[model samples]
Target: MMRVSLSGARGLMLISTLLLSTTAFAAPDATKIANSVVASLQAKGGTKASFDSAAANGDDVVITNLKISNEGSEATVPSVVIASPVERTPGGFTAKSIAFDAGKVVDGDQTISWKTGISNDAIVPDPSEMHSTAKITPFSHFEIAGISVVNKSAPDPVTVDSVTFDLGNVIDGAPNDGKLAISGINVPGSVLKSAGQGASTLTDLGYDSLLLNIGVDGGYDSAKNALTINGITVDGKDIGKLAIGGTFGGLPREKLQNADQLKELAPTATLEVASIRYDDAGLTNRLLDMQAKQLGAKREDLVAMVPGFLPLAFSQVNITDEAFKTQVSDAVSAFLKDPKSLSIKFAPTAPVLLMDVSKAAMVNPNGVISLLGVGVSANN
Candidate 1:
């Protein structure tokens, strides 16, 4: 009888240990995760956020009737889904993905709506860190599809195919690199013609709709205290493409948190290198032809007039040096005649300090051009 009793007691201890292990690995609370996200949003600024309900659906949490407001603007989502969420810290969570369906934002007489949006590898940090110097971001990458804007004053809606932002990684609350891509921005010709002044140039250039795509990519190096811009490009189908790239130095990680600190560091900041390049698909020639027609002249005649006009334009900007002005005039004349590719480059003998450049500009603006090592080339 004693041996049987001891065996039963051992079996009970084994059963209790198994139960404890299961409880330790239990799923995260869905409702708590939803509330923490609302808390984080509110902590960010003059924003209010809430959700009607949150419940677990398999491994995902579905938040219903999510709404956010800032100032007089309000946005509402029918539902949001956070998939496979895991707690990273107390009141912080990371998820495999988050999704939004059919959201609308209302601001005065204008409304913006989207069919769907999704973010991958999302991070929701503690509320206390939202306004801190940490600069925490919520997601690594996100995309929204079928975005439409409607206004009471406008005749028709403007639509976008997609808008996306990507941050490769977050370390110490800063992105290692970043990108923003906006594609298929369609604005009607009537809207452009009515938008006053030079906007009509777009329509006159035979653009029924200004279908534009914009992209920006950049990265930072903490070790070198530098920021590198891969490129910021604007491409219009059948029009032209413009790209700008540059590198800047003397930006330490800590100074990024405060505008005042950055301002103080600006004097010592350096422009290491910079470039602007434009490739004309057809728009450059078309624009020159249109302008020539308006002035009752041929395209070649218009091109010839630019070299004479440039000095007058440069003089307005305090550019008095004849040699510098001549260089610019010749480059512009060549580009206008060929309508091919034009590139402007700056590569100083050494990284140029902002303070020296500023003082030189005030003393002699024309000298500042040479001080920056400006170079322009056409059809190269």
Candidate 2:
């Protein structure tokens, strides 16, 4: 028995036959790869089209408690426990978030722990190796929290503590290439004034609680075709301290040059906040002397007059967490007495995809603006 060493037992039987040939090579149906990543993020529209229509018609968007843990030969990365029920229909939006935790990806790293909004720890990759590699790169931290969205002429109820997306390297390749990113984001002026239809600026600023700070660098290079939004910074204390500069130019070339006359042109991308401040309250020189009497113009013409007179722009704004700062300061004093009705609307020929705005600036004497800086260009 002391001499039983046949070449170390044939190298431990070839490392147990390559760990049973990578576990018998069959592990690719994480609910059909999470429904083809929720249908390629609903055909790549903005704000990922409200999370792809709340994961397609809301209600248990798959992920029924899957748990797989292995460490010895390294093979973990499957720990999802989700319970969803989010309805945003005709005017009857509903909400529900119970025990949502995610994290467990050892070899390729992907961590998660849930409570509703969503906890974080991510390095993500191996969506089963991105289904045999057409082009799969991953790095993530897409967090969410106790989020809520309701309609039917809202009065009270809109909460989201977090919405983090630091998708560093999300490339999925070829002609229709890829890229999605995020950098240092913090949203919580009670989820940006409880979103849409104005929650009354937290009852006229008697101050209960309000805090929304945000930061995000940009990138979306489908192989240098271009879509780079590299600016947007906002601070808050009841709708003050803002900075939204510029940098958005021609970006629509994931190979769909015509796709039937660009699907009947309805393209749009606008952003303008040109200036705002209140900590010291210089009021940017009384809003640049009221834009120099509406003609001697300055502040980049009030941020390029936001698409010729405001409709949508101020790309990505944030002030998360606020209960009811005097109903968001009397709805930002009636949205600055009609600041062009502060708008937000998206409809690239809708298909379970739309984002309308105005919960009185999305909630708490609030002012939560988030525009993924819309893009789609190529009209040489």
- Measured by TM-score, the strongest candidate is 1
lDDT of each: 0.86, 0.36
RMSD (Å) per prediction: 3.4, 21.7
State every prediction's TM-score relative to the real structure: 0.90, 0.26
TM-score of candidate 2 relative to the true fold: 0.26
The C-alpha stretches of model 2 lying farther than 4 A from their native spots are: 1-79, 82-99, 102-114, 117-124, 127-141, 147-160, 166-210, 213-217, 222-227, 239-241, 248-380
Error of 2 at 15 (Å): 39
Off by over 4 Å in 1: 1-25, 135-137, 169-173, 314-323
Give candidate 1's error at residue 308 in angstroms.
Answer: 2.0
Native-referenced Cα lDDT, model 1: 0.86
Candidate topping lDDT: 1
lDDT of each residue in 169-202, candidate 1, tens digit only: 6777667799999999988877787777777878
Error (Å) of candidate 2 at residue 309 is 35
